[model samples]
Every structure is written in structure tokens, then in C-alpha cells.
Target: MKSCYLTRPGLLCALGADTDTVAEALFAGQQQGLVLEQGWLAHDHNAAVRVGRVAATLPILPPAWQARASRNNRLLLAAVQQIMQEVERCKQRYPAHRIGVVLGTSTSGVDHAEWALEAHAAQGQLPEGFQFEQIDLGDPARFLADWLELTGPAYCISTACTSGSKALVSARNLVQSGMCDAVITGGVDTLCRLTLNGFTALESTTSELTNPLSLNRAGINIGEGAAVFILSAEPGAVQLLGAGESSDAYHISAPEPEGLGASAAMQAALRDAGLDETSIGYLNLHATATIKNDAMESKAVDRVFPHGVPVSGTKGMTGHALGAAGALEAAFCYLSLTDTQGRLPPHCWDGVADPALPALPLVQVGQQWRPGPRYAMSNSFAFGGNNLSLILGGGA
Candidate 1:
């Protein structure tokens, strides 16, 4: 495969509305964005749950794009707006058809549908603005393609939590296969009753702050946000060094307990990057704070990095963004690569560590990576034993 670079990035998440604000908040270990809120449950009687949300006001879609209006697209728009200039530059450098849009999303616009359904149950008709296209899984990509007037390949990947990471992988393939000169990639997802209620039914949520790798760790706090990256043949400061994916299909909703599949993904990424395990300086763990996820990930990480590498689970501050979590965490790694201070995202959790799991070197608030070539690995594992690992290298 040819070298594929991540030229520019735009991010909106619980950490902050843009990449700079988010990078500052992430390095400081700020948890103010994660808050306990109510009104997400199926029944009004359910208690409030902690969730990471974007407090910033998102831009509204223009009247011309009303058919694709929804909170989900609004988040994606906020991110894309940050890089609009760069995206336009790409259009000038390459033909419109050579620029593609590929994104990942789990709840495209279902929140809007949920509200429309409520009104239908009581009013006997769908709301005036309600459109069936709002809830389509492919709406995000379609909306971007239309908004940017790009005729290249545009699509969405919806493989549970691996959606975002898989989108990045697909974008790289497009560039390497000579199908596109540049690709708009990453993912976006918004908080909604449907997503929260689904996790609640699966017993994968907690009322308190998420605590990863802690003895008293309970469950994950849901979050909403989006991260957008411009990938192309253009040389840039940061590059997508390697990508690996695996699916064990061990169970419908549980990871392979021993992490056999997870380890395979990491190993494959290392091989793809043409670097050994020791080359990685920091690792962004897929720490959802769930017992099974943490346990399985711990074993998988240990198997891949026996000598141990600095690792931290960022969900303590950003909450799992479901399908968008992969891109969100990758944004964290990208921020770290650009930081001159060599700062790493700290592990936020109780002081107590689980004795049953292997001991891993969790990052501290002021900890920094060694001075040299900076390579960070991020892992994302989803339902059905689907797993992905991405390696980002730069800031040498």
C-alpha cells in the first residue's frame, strides 16, 4: 500500500468544540464535560445517567438541505466547518470527482425520527418536517456529498463501534487503489434516547462517572460527538501508519474473553506499519469501563505489548461515542502527536486497580512520551467481536 497521510482534522466532542480546545482539555484531564443528565431513558422513572455531550451550539443546516436536517448532521457539520478551507483547497488541487466523502455513524438522524414518532402517536400524523431520509444510516455521507458537490465515492460504514475506524481504513484504501485523490473521513454520532435506551437494556450503562480499570468499575457513560479527517496523498505532519481489523464473531454482544481476536488485530497493525511493538510510545485503550470490555482489552493489550507500553482509557472524560468512539479516540492520538510538550492523555479512574487483570502502565496527568519518533496506537472493539487498531505516526 502507498503512504496515506492524515493532512487535516476537525473535531467536536465532550472535550471541546474544536481540535485546539479539545487538545487543551484532554491534556489537563478535564472531566467537567461529563455530566449526569436525565430524560434519556425509555421510562421517565429511570434515574439520570452520566454522559459526555457537546455543550457548544452547533450550526444549523441551510434551508436547501432541510431534507437532511438533524442533530447528528449538525455535529458533523460543526467538524467539517473547521476544515472547510482545507477541503476547498482540495477541490482546487484535484477534480471534484476525485474528492470523496466516507463517514461512519450509528444514529444518523434517529433522534429526529424518535421525536416525529412521539408526535405521531399523539397527533395521528407525522410532523410536517419529518422525512424518512433523516433516519437513513447513509444520510451522513449523502449529506456531505451533496453539500460539497462531490461526485466521488461516498458511503457510510455501520459496523457497531468499529464504524469510525473502519471508515478511516476504507478511506486509505480508496486513495491507495487510485480511486480518489483525497477523501473526507471519520465519524459523527449524537446522543439520543434510542442509543441510551439500547445500552440500558443491554446493561451497559452506569449512573456514576465511568471508571475504567478500577476495582469498582461499573459501566460506561454514553457520549456524543464527531471527528473529521482529510486523508490524501499529500504529505503532511501526521500520517496513518497502519490499520488492522478482525472479527471473531464469538458472540453477539460480548468480546472473546481471552482477547484472541483483539490481539490479532493489534499484531496485524504492527505488521502493516512495518514497526515492532516497541515502536509505539502510547496507546489509547478502548476502555468502555464495562467489566467484560476492560477485562478482554487488558488481556489483548498485554499479549501484544508484553514489555508493556504507556496506556490510558480516555472514555473517563469523553464517554463512549458508540460508532463514533473510534474516530473520537483517534482524534485524541492525533492531538497528542501534534503537541510539542509530548503530553499524553491521563488515565482517569479510582486509585484502586483490579488485581485480576495484568498490571499496565497507566498514564499520569503530566506524563509525556519519550523524545523521539512519536507513534501512537488506538484500539476499538465492538459487538460481535469486531476489533480495529490504527497507528498514527509523526512529530518526530
Candidate 2:
């Protein structure tokens, strides 16, 4: 099968939109997560939790784009615009027909649905001029394709939190199958009361900032962001390397204990990359800070990388962006690979250590590391034990 390579990638997250800004913040050990302001959490008394929220509101898009008011759509549009601008710079290499767009989002436009319903309750009718397409699950992908004039296949992946990572897999397949010469794959998720209150109802909303793998760790704080990457068949680019996915079917909202399925996903990714576990120099763990999730992840990592490999979770900086988490973190990995010095920001393990969590070498300080790693892996496990892992590395 033909290989897929990542050419250009970008991110818009809580830390900052541009790559330099976000990278600087990460390397500086500057924390972006903060306690929710009282104004934003007017009614929720449990707003003390620190959230990784973008300091700036999404900018206004063209008038044509504004017709779609869904928060998810807005973020998707922003990411797509940024990605297209990059593509335009290298337009000769990736033409229109050769390009594709594949995105992931769990809540698509549900925020708009909630707003429509609320407006109807007060005005006795659905909000005027509200287009149903704006709230459709495929709207983000379709709108992006149209906006970029991309004629290749367009798709949307919605497998809960694994959505973004799954989209990358889909984009890789499309290129390997010769369906498109180049593809843009990533995820976008925006803040909404539905997710906030829903997690709160499940008692998964952490009271304090999340402490992944910490014995005192609480739950997870929901966050919003978007990330996108350009993939092609050309050489010299950061290769996708390989991807693995599995489903345990244990529960709708919990991972299987012992991480049976999560372990399989990691092992499969390594097998696809044709490398042993020891070859993986660093890992971006799916440390959401939730008890079950963190425990299961720790077990999986221990099973795979027992040599004290460097591992860290950026969720401490970006919170949990759900569907967008995988893609955003993947962007971080890509940056780590291509930056002047191959280095990644340390995972903020601020609180006391947790004895129950497995012992893995966690990168806890921001510093430059020389000699780029040959391989790196990213893990994304979602509800129902839907697990996905991707192994990426410097060009062969």
C-alpha cells in the first residue's frame, strides 16, 4: 500500500492559534488552563475547575460563512481557512482535485440545536432563518470542502473522542487508495452548555484542575479547539507511519478494565509501523484525568512501553477538547518532530504523585532536546472502548 505523509500542519487551541505562540507557551511551561470566571459560569456552582480555554474568541468569518452559527462549525471554518492559506502557499504541489478534507466532531452542531430549541421556547417558533444544514453532522466537512474548493472526497468522522484520530486514519486511507493525492485531516470542537452540563450530570466534571495519573486526580475539564494537517504522498514529509484502531464494546461511556482494547490498539500501531515498543521514543498519552480513563491508560502504557520512555499528556494545557483532542495533540507531535530542535513541552504533573498509577518517565520540564527521535506515538481512547493509536516519525 502507498504511504501517506504529513506535509503541513496547524493548530488553534487554548494556548494560542499560531504554531510559534503555542510552541513557545508549551516550552515556557506556561499553563493555559485556568479557573472558570464567575461570569461564564453564572449558574454552575462547580465552576472552580480549571479549564484550558482559548483566550480569544473565534474571529468572524465571511458573511457567507456566518450563516452557519454552530460553535463547532465556526471552529472548523477557522481551522479550514488557516489550512487552506498554507495550502495556497504551496499550491503547485497540491492542486484542487488532488486535495481532500476529512474532519471529526462528536457534537457537530448540537449547540445550535439547543439554541434553536431555546429560541422556540421563548419566541413560540424556531429561530428565524435557521438552516438545518448548519446543525447537520456533515455540515462542517461539506462547508470546508466548498470553502477551499476541494474536489476530492469529503468525509466526517464522529466516533466520540476518537473522532479526530479516526479522521486522520480515513484521510490516510484515501491517499493510500489513490482516491486523493493530498488530504486535510483533523478535528474541531467548541464549548457548549450541553457538554458541560452533561458531563456534570455524570459527575465527571472535576472540581479542581485535572491531575492525570495523580492519586489526587479528580475528573476532566471540557475544552474547545481545532487542529488540521495536510497529508500527501510526497517524500521528506513527516510520515503517518501507521495507525491502529479497536473496539471493546464493553460499555458506552467507559473503557474496559486492564485496557484490553487500548493495549491492542497500541500494539497494532507498532506492528503497522514495523517497529518494536522500544523504538517509540516518546508518547502523547490520552490522559483525561478521569479515574477510570487515566488508570486504564496507565496500564496500557505500562504494557507497551516499560523502558521508562518519556510520556506526557497535553490535556493539562488544553483540557479535554473531546473529538478535537487527538488531532490537536497530533499537531503537537508534528511540531515536535519538525521544530529546529526536536523537543516537546513537559506534561504538568504539578500535584502529588499517585502510587496507583504505573511508573513511566514523564517529561516534566520544558527544554530543548537534540537529535530528533526516530518514532513517536499518540493514543486516543474514547467512550465504549473505541481506541485508536497513530505512530509517526521523522522521514526515513
Candidate 3:
């Protein structure tokens, strides 16, 4: 297979609004962006929940693109703005049709729809600027394609949490298949009422800082942000080495007990990368802090790396970005792979580990890995048992 190089990545989340800011905060194990706030739940205005919200001022979309305007798209625009130089470089080197766009998102403009509905009920008409296309799942990709003027394959993936990582996998295929020479890929999600309330109904949201892999672990904290990358055939600082995907469909909302499906995805990624357990220097786990998820993932990691590998669950800091979680965590691994000091992202959780789970080597603050070609794996298991594992390697 032709190799796909992951060029400069643009990411913004609860950590910060750019790669450097987020990386600095990530290595420092900072959770300053995650704050307690209320008003997300319509039925309960007094309920304050800890959430990973982007505190930075976002760029506004031009009036020409007003129809596509939404917080979800704005977050995506914020990320893309960071990579404009590289994107322009690609435009100079390739035809418009040779550049593709593939993004993953869940709550695309749903918040706008919520507002429109409220206005309609109060005023007997849809909001003056509301458009049905804003709520479409494909809007993010469409907005990006029009913004960049790229005529290649542009689309969105919406398999719950795995959407973002799956976009990377699919973008790699497009490049390797010669469908495009370069593709803008990654994920973006915004805070919205539908998702917050939906997960609340499922009893999957936590009001406190999410405590993943801890005895007191309760549930996840919903977050919003975006991570965009330029994926090309040209070699770059980081490379997308391999990817594995599987859909076990074990449950609609819960992962398979014992992690049979999760293990399959991880093992497949290793096989795809032509590496074994010891080759991975670090792992960014899909630790949502939910009871069943943490338990199942523990077994899966233990099964794949019986000898133990350095691992960390980062949801405590970024909250879960839902469809963007996979890509956001993958971006964390990308940042780790490129760190000159070999600083591994610390697991942002209370110092407590559940004794019942396997004794995985969770990374601590100031943790550093050995010098050499660094390889890391990021896991994303979504609803309905959709799972994906991505292997990224940097250095010689």
C-alpha cells in the first residue's frame, strides 16, 4: 500500500485553540479549559456539568457562507484556519480535483435547529436565517469543500464516536487508491443540547471532571472541538502507518463485555502496521470513564499487550468529543509522536487506579519515552460496537 503522510495537524478543543497551545497544555496535564457550566440541559437550568468547551474566540464565517453558518462548522473553520499555509501549498502543487476532503461529525448544526424550533414556537415562523441544510450530516464536509474550493471526494462519517478516526482511515484509502494526491481529513464537533440530553438519557454524562479508569469512575463529560490534518503522499514529520476497523454490533449503546471486539481492532492495527506488542511506545486509550467501557477496554488492552504498554486515558481533560473523540485523541498521539523531548501526554485523571482492572502503565506527568522512531496507537470504540485503531509513527 502507498504510504500516507500526516502533515501539519490543526486541532482545537478544551485544551486550547491551536496545536502548540494544546500540546503545551496536554504535556502539562492541564484541564483548565474544562469548566463547570449550566444551561445545556433545557429541562434543568440549574444543573452545572463539567464540560470541555473551547474558550477561545472562534473565527466567523463570511456572509457568503452564512447558510452554512453554525457553531459546529465554525469550530471546523477554526481548525482549518490553522493549516491554511499548508493547504495553500497543496493547492499550488495539486489540481483542485486532486485534493479531497473527508470529515467526521455527529452534531452538525443541530443546535441551530434547536434554536429555530424555539423561534417557531414563539413567533409562528422558522427563524429568518434558518436552513434545513444546516442540520444535514453532510454539511461539515460540504462547507469545507466550498470553502477550500476542492472538487474531490468530500463527505462526512457519523458512526458515533468513531467517525473522526474513521475519516483518517478512509482518507488514507483515497490517497493510496490514487483517487487523490492529497486529502484534508479529521473531525469536528460542537457542544449542543441534543447530544448532551441524548447521552444524559443514556445516563452516560458526568457533571464532574470525568474520572476514567478509576474506581470512582462514573461517566463521560461531553466536549466540543475540531482537529484537521493535511494527508498527502509527500513524506512529512508524521506518517499514518496503519489503521484497523471493525463493527462487532455487540450492543447499541454498550461495548462487548470482555472486549472481544476491541481486541480484534487493536490486533488488526498491529498486523496492518507489521508490528507487534512491544513496538508500540505509547497508547491513547478510549477511556470514557463509564463503568462498562473502562472494564471492557482494560481486558482488550491486556489481551493485546500482555507485557504491558505505556497508556493513558485523556477524557478527563478533553471530555469526550463523541464523533470527534477518535480524531482528537489521534491528534494527541500525533502530537506525542512529533514531540522533540519525547514527552508523553499524561493521563489526566485522579491518581487512583482501579485494582480490578489490569495494571496498565498509565503515563504520569513529566513522563518521557525513549528516543528513536516513535510509534503510538489510539483506540476509538463507538456505539453499536464500531471500533477503530490507528497507528502513527514519527522520526527515522
Top lDDT hit: 1
Off by over 4 Å in 2: 38-49, 89-95, 367-372
Q: Could you estimate the TM-score for every candidate? A: 0.99, 0.93, 0.98
Q: Write the per-residue lDDT of candidate 1 for residues 1-396, one digit (tens) a residue.
A: 679898658998899999899999999988889998877887764578889999999997779888788999989999999999999899999998999899989999999999999999999999897899989999999999888899999999998899999999999999999999999999999999988988989899998889999989999899999999999989898899998889999999999999999999999999999999999999999999999999989999999999999999999999999889999888899888888888999999987999999899999998998878999999999999999999999963
Task: Give the range where candidate 1 is weakest over 10 consecutive residues by summed lDDT.
Answer: 38-47
Model 3, range 1-396, lDDT digits (tens) per residue?
888899768999999989999999999999888889988887897899788999989888778888898989999999999999999999999999999999999988898999999899999999888999989999999899999999999999998999999999999999999999999999989888899988998898888889999988989999998999999989898899988888899999999999999999999999999999899999999999999999999999999999999999888889999888888998999888888788998987777889998878899989988665699999999999998999998853
- Determine the backbone clash count of candidate 3: 0
| Candidate 2, poorest ten consecutive residues by summed lDDT | 33-42
lDDT of 2 by residue, 43-131 (tens): 66545655677665665767766677677777776666666676775456677777888998877887788788879989999987677
- Pitting candidate 2 against candidate 3, the one with the higher lDDT is 3
Q: Give the Å error, residue 165, model 3.
A: 0.2
lDDT of each: 0.92, 0.79, 0.91
Q: Considering summed lDDT, which 10 consecutive residues are worst modelled in model 3?
A: 365-374
Q: 216 in model 3: Cα distance from truth in Å? A: 0.5
Q: What is the C-alpha RMSD of each candidate to the true structure, in Å?
A: 0.9, 2.3, 1.0
